[model samples]
Target: MPDLRKEIINILDGKLLTPHFQPIVSLTHKKILGYEALIRGPSNSPLHSPFNLFTTAERFNLSTKLEFLCREITIQRYADLDIKEKLFINASPLVLLQPEFKKGETLRLLDQYGVNPRSVVIELTEHKPADNYEIMRASAKHYRGMGFEIALDDLGAGYSGLRLWAELLPEYVKIDKHFVHSLHNDPIKLNFVRSIQSMAVSLNCSVIAEGIETQEEFKAIEKIGITNAQGYYFARPTAVPVKEIDKALFAIEQDTDCKSAPFNNATTAVQIIRDITPISAKTTISDVMNLFHHNSELTILPLVDDNIASGIIFRDKFLTKLFSSRYGIDLHGKNPIKMFIENTPLCIDKNMPIDLVSKQLTSLMTNDPAFIITHNGEYMGVGTLLDLLAEFTRQQIDNAKHANPLTLLPGSVPINNQINQLLANKIPFGFGYFDLDNFKPFNDVYSYDAGDAIIKAVANTLIQYIPAESGRVGHIGGDDFIVIFTCDDWLTRCKNILKAFESTVPSHYSDKDINAGGIHTENRAGEKCFFPLISLSVGLVDPVSTSQCQSHVDIADLASEAKKMAKKIPGNSLFINQRMAAKNSGNFQSFTHSATKLHIVN
Candidate 1:
């Protein structure tokens, strides 16, 4: 019955909302990097969280006023903190674009509270539509120029998060806890987070995994590459300032304890085969020479007859015997099988202890000949010192192939090969291309290392969004990445990936750049200007007509063109570019240029 909206407005104007501080911890040093400010309505009020308050305020057409009041009060309350430590303040895109929210006014407010913009990180939430992103990005650039940092909040949870990340290259990307929560139980999630961490490293941005509650979750994220964390397990949102975080610090220190145990439990075995060729068994001396050439390390070849081990011919002895014989050339056709001694060599099992075999072979002292292994008096497998060493070398190569050199992700080759195999089977699939918008300028301003970090962050975001049953994600080098989905729910997977990427991307930038919502750069004329905000333009190419008529190259080209079209649209956009239902016999219109020649595949 009462005007709840009016009452809430009165309460907010009176600065009745209480500000709570949650600590953002550094996983590496187990120290508190800064505190994120959380707003709560008056005790027992219906609007408890700022999210609810702001949502209600927008419905009542009073969001701008509410945001200003909250921002003003939050800064004034935490003004005395050390400048080096950061303070996170949440701001919606709508509130940021307000005419009253000018750069000069925001700076003046910070000056009044003795706070520097450099120390204040404005966390941009995905509460409003990103239709006006160019304007929002322009505002973000202005604010960043004044020293405030920017952050894309709730990464990995929204549709436009990836697009927002490309447009606004934030200094730090806060990884959504949803992906971090089940990392230990999911290989896909673990790999996804690792990719994000790698991208963050490339962008020169810091990463903080949010919502790390259980010891298992914390340990999983820490092992895979997350260095900052927040959640209930560490410390929940609190109104009181935290002077010490001994519990959180201790939990991080013990995080590795949970990881090493599982890693140590993994065991594997190697298979080996034995050499059983002999000179005496062959009719011709050339036969012995051929055996030695095939296996250079075959010092002694064992001869067998009628299921019984026979004579052993040493390499040096056989060579001397062959050269001394006047019938060497004519012996090529001779049957060495009949000339070899019968029941002369010994055999052992492949698994027999090497120490025991070494002693036995040494005691025999028959030209220090190599021993062979057999089962049921038949050749089964081999085990030699050199074989063991070769197996070890092979294992290393296999490990390297799966490891992403930059993000330590199983490299692009494996991902691509897997996707191609899946497609070759004519399975229904969805492919999405993810790219960072306006990343070049960010890299120029911040450095290539920072750009690399952003790339890894984007890759991690895509990995997190992929469904458990979804196909592999191929890193197509640099900032471009591809994710394939074979299940019935492909659109959902693509949407989820885009959302996560945008939400987590802001953690990569300084508070100023993030607050500005876009990177600043010089134009061709060398005049300072703001490029359009960065974002991911996802082009989805489904296997409909594409399956029958489209080649992989054709589909890929179409997807890329669709992505470029999407990027051209202001703010975050997604486009599904399918092949034309009916093929045109004549010239085809280029999406960008004029009508062009068409080449039909025969």
Candidate 2:
């Protein structure tokens, strides 16, 4: 311990700190959003680990000095490397509050290195519990005021992390690795992440999942819509990091995961673009008024700079402001159009799903019926609410034509279309065909209404259990449902659904039936017999690629056959037919499950 302490002191004295950078990637844009600077001591020394180095510094009452040195080294190294992305430097709250810590030291270092303060994020990495929330909050606010964004690091790994988050209101919060490891298989972890994501959305803050080490974990994080993530899965922390993201890390021709709108994968913002000519920001308001007068149908004048949309101008609002008073037009006529522009107008990519576009447009809550459309961030055209509503309604009506009336889930047509879309994209997925075991016997015992209740219950369970990002739930008429899974842990989600069904389905039964564990009903031959409780049977098939299945028809046939195999196992069962195995042998090596036992069928 004494030796480590001396080493840390000597290292700090010599300013021997190494800054390793890891890229934080934006899943939506498929680009490197920024890089977080991680510090290390001499590699061959005992204080090489950050934990050992920092703890030793803290133990020797040199934490403030060590932290300042780390920040200076990180900023200088990051600038020296000519990294274009934002740099995140770790700072301790305790050190920030210490009397020795200067207020503008970080800003000074950034200036000396010729780096913008706005491009730096001061990540609060708590080494100890902050007893004074007021000072910590004020310190964080001070950093923000200096144009440095704050990020709360290792959330859920330290004391009062949530409280600190509430106080600091960081622009970014990173989830600890505990929640990210094996996230694909653990529903609990997935739920935790989803809840955090929900909070991040409401607060308008971004989330970064740290310590991701596998593709499954990355996929789960991406599916949950976390804005940015950094871990060894993309690249390990190093002195020099890769600038651009590898094309192989993500699918180049991936389809947006449309949970609510099944057919939205086909319709995009480009389809509804109105192709209205845009005016430059430097154009005078007087010129815009003349243009609007000349074009009677033009209610919106999109403002563009360098072919990138800057804002929008509504004719009614612009005219109202100009004519509300006698001096309005004379006072503002010569002003640039940018003065009247609403800078927060909804600007979305041309390929964004129409449903998602509609949601964003509605969120603006503006009476102005127009939004700016961009293709790869360049102005493409303008879209109006009328066109969006018309197209959305048309698709909804078309969807309803093939939707199940009872459950309102997608029927055969949309389901088939979704399957083909997945296949066309060559995205590997799994399909589970769900069928009610002994459903007809339940209909015999209970009336048709009770039977319908059971079917609806199954549909609701599927919706509740299957996450929309991981899979799409569709009702294929009565007593039949299907799921197309894009997540790697499809079987885990399927088992969770089975467990949930087993637990909840008993509520629909009477006390007598519950006690007896069976219902007295007439058989197919019209003879009296005892029937067991209604349960679910799910057949799972993992199609690796397009070569295994040419079309949705082949997928349906394979899924249907797997369902039959699952049904053979009695109640509340799941059967997985290895499609990859079948690709070679022309036969299935099946793994079937009963309520409490596993069966291997070769």
Which regions in candidate 2 have their CA more than 4 angstroms from the true location?
1-265, 324-335, 363-367, 505-532, 543-548, 580-582, 586-602
lDDT of 1 by residue, 1-602 (tens): 55768768777778788778888876544567788888888776778777677678888877777777777777877875443578988776666656665546667888898886788887776744556577558756865887878887878886676677767888777877778877889988887887787677556566788888887887666555466788876788887767556744434422332222111111111144554443234445566677677988877666554333434566676665556653353564354533433222445544343333444446444333344465434444334556644655674576467666676555545555444444454555666676777888888888999888888887777666663345556676677777666566776666565566666667777788888877779866788878644566676666563465334566677678768766665554566666543343332222111123222211
- lDDT string for model 2 (370-449, tens) is 87776655679999899999999997888889889899988888888878876765667888899998789888677899
Which candidate number has the best lDDT?
2
lDDT of each: 0.63, 0.79
lDDT (Cα, 0-100) at 526 in candidate 2: 92
What is the C-alpha local distance difference test score of candidate 1?
A: 0.63
Question: Judged by TM-score, which candidate is best?
Answer: 2
Alpha carbon deviation, residue 152, candidate 2 (Å): 25
Ten contiguous residues with the weakest lDDT in model 1? 261-270
Candidate 1 at residue 441, lDDT?
80
